[model samples]
Target: MASLWSKISATLPLNEEQFPLQFSNKVESSVVERLRQSRQQLYSNTTSTSRMLNAQIILDISWEKLNTGTWRDVDKEWRRVYSYGCLFKAAALCRENPSEDELLQAVRTCDMGLLMGAAIMDNILQDIVRILQCEVRKSVKEEDEGEHMQVKRRKTASPHVPSIKDGLAVPRIKCPSLESFNTNYLLPLKPVILEGIIDHWPALNTHPWSIDYLRSVAGCRTVPVEVGSRYTDEDWSQTLLTVNEFIDRYILNKSQISPDGVNDVGYLAQHQLFDQIPELKEDIRIPDYCSLGEGDEDDITVNAWFGPTGTVSPLHQDPQQNFLAQVVGSKYIRLYSPEDTDKLYPHQSQLLHNTSQVEVENPDTEHFPEFIKAPYLECVLQPGDVLFIPVKHWHYVRSLEVSFSVSFWWS
Candidate 1:
């Protein structure tokens, strides 16, 4: 236990000089004093649960202020407060001879801060969490080697292509030049299937993104998942689960049960997973075509979508240009031009204004009569295919098998 603590401690910043809480310039001196006092209380008695709880209360006060304004307008001091709280809790847990669950909780707390907090604070928690994850993966591998091998064998088998529904097929080009793509696709606002562009991605070759490899690296990390048939359903809700739990219940178990027997669906959709798990991010590369737009490379937003077959993303439109890259499995997609927006019948509510009321696959013709006449282009997105969708173009998607996709959105 002492050796374990030594390893954890070594990963953390050793002193205030290395990890200072210098928010006095950005916030009131009184607020800075409160943060300093709370940090001191944690270090004074690192194993005291009561002290940790008290520090959390102080941080929570700062956190509540963040919700009062738009995210970009919120004071940086508040984000730092939340980040510091996560770091304090992680350090306290490390001193108490923490269990595996405790370590995971600490890592998750830090990850939340990293995702939502300010960048001014030191990322001391990143190193601490990586060390913790490595230890957990070691134990998991020792116990589940046989199961892991079974999954690898199953995943390596060729994926079956399902029949795609009828619609005008989106045009496919074999890696068009930047000038050609901009002239024919980007400027014209036409959606096109790009081939030969993503074949060099490591995800398709040397370090393939297989089930076993994903479970090994991120099995213990916690992530948010959408539970229920699809987001359009009233029952649709979101919850957090470890990567292993999601794979076991949603991906692996689905294979064993009959399609009709399956009740609930879990989808890890539209998540910035790369920012949390840097290891998985290494497997992918952003398309060079993103540079054709006005936005800088840093302005691009990358999101991951992973789920089983039958998962649906109801007809919706996005505000930016999208490059949907399929890494594993396949999907059937339908696209309607912005000119058909009125026919598609968008929701009246401010929250769902971008989503159409009509189900693309099974339309309610009586209520949305115009939707029946809305012409659309469809395609079967296979492995290594990148579908370039113009801004505000209505699109509907459904997975044909257990799938993983990465989408890059830029202005």
Candidate 2:
């Protein structure tokens, strides 16, 4: 297998742009180059025996040798190999006439290889799972073209709003200078709504960050969208979908709501979409306020939040200060000071200790009596409004309409 891979590698030039998989410096460039060639051939749909064997060799080596690093390192490396085309190769190389169980074994082998490469890897590996699932469906469709398959669709429940009473709202300022914001809000860890700050953004005017424009530009790019009413819900899950599919099913179509039930909400939340599709990034300029931090503009981490109305981000705190810029629609935001963590009934679960268990809109007094004592601030963020949330401030957000928000996180 090794000798065959060497021969194959000798035939192709190392094309870094085509294959962006990066191995650590510990691995020789020659080895990385060979693996890239094998992955390319595997996805090229070449059914030659030698090509399959070479792909198997690449998988085997990656599995055996890629296990010595932090989980983050391991995850990066595994995603690199998996995304580059190893899983597809494993599926195609099952056999000339493979049984269903045999094909399943191919998936299992690929899964086991990812685990072997990174022992601490524990994510559902949604990217690989979606690919294999699609492959299985395609093969089954090929075999049963004459038969009609009935698909069962489950509609996810929409979030129910509890009653609300008035509270002190976060102060709203129109185009406050960077010095005032840094001196008053940043220093005091106060939440404030700054209006007229995003009018200059190309996204607001020239770029047309609307549904038609996004579909035209980034429809085919694969993205991870959260599918559920809220992250705190038991049914919460993540799936990979094309931007077009997300836009059509969740954004453009109102078919999600019917007498039967509300459909599963798909939210493109907290994703580094700017990094994935750079063309979209050109539309928005980093705010001057973000530069008030110690680092330069490049140090800011920008993320996107897009979802239908009623999408809720349950009460939670983030480590970095955040400026959430409302781009397309309105959002109802509530914030609690970090000092009130004890009063908010923080979750007892280790994974969610930073999140408040009490639903802020309507707290069950019997369960979370202390929550009412937590002084809170609220605001309805409109398009062109930017809300600054201090680090560790417990915040909850619910969209008032089909919304698109850009968030910049910085120290």
Best by TM-score: 1
- For candidate 2, the 10 contiguous residues with the lowest summed lDDT are 147-156
Worst 10 residues of 1 by lDDT: 254-263
lDDT tens per residue, model 2, 1-411:
123233323333354344345577655576577666765764465656766676566665565545556545654554455433354354344435555555545545444444343322232233333344344545555443332121113233353333444557788888888789988899998899888988999999988677656754555455778998778778889886767678767765543443322358889975557755567888898888988888777778999999877777889999999999999978888899898889888889988888888776667899888888888888888889999999999999987667899999999
Clashing residue pairs, candidate 2? none
How does each model score on lDDT? 0.80, 0.68
Candidate 2 Cα outliers beyond 4 Å, as residue runs: 1-167, 253-263
Report RMSD for candidate 2. Answer: 9.3
Residue 410 lDDT, candidate 2, scale 0-100: 93
Clashing pairs in 1: none
Q: After superposition, how far is residue 333 of candidate 1 from its true place, in Å?
A: 0.1
Task: List candidate 1 stretches off by more than 4 Å.
Answer: 1-14, 24-34, 41-75, 149-167, 255-263
Global CA lDDT computed for model 1: 0.80
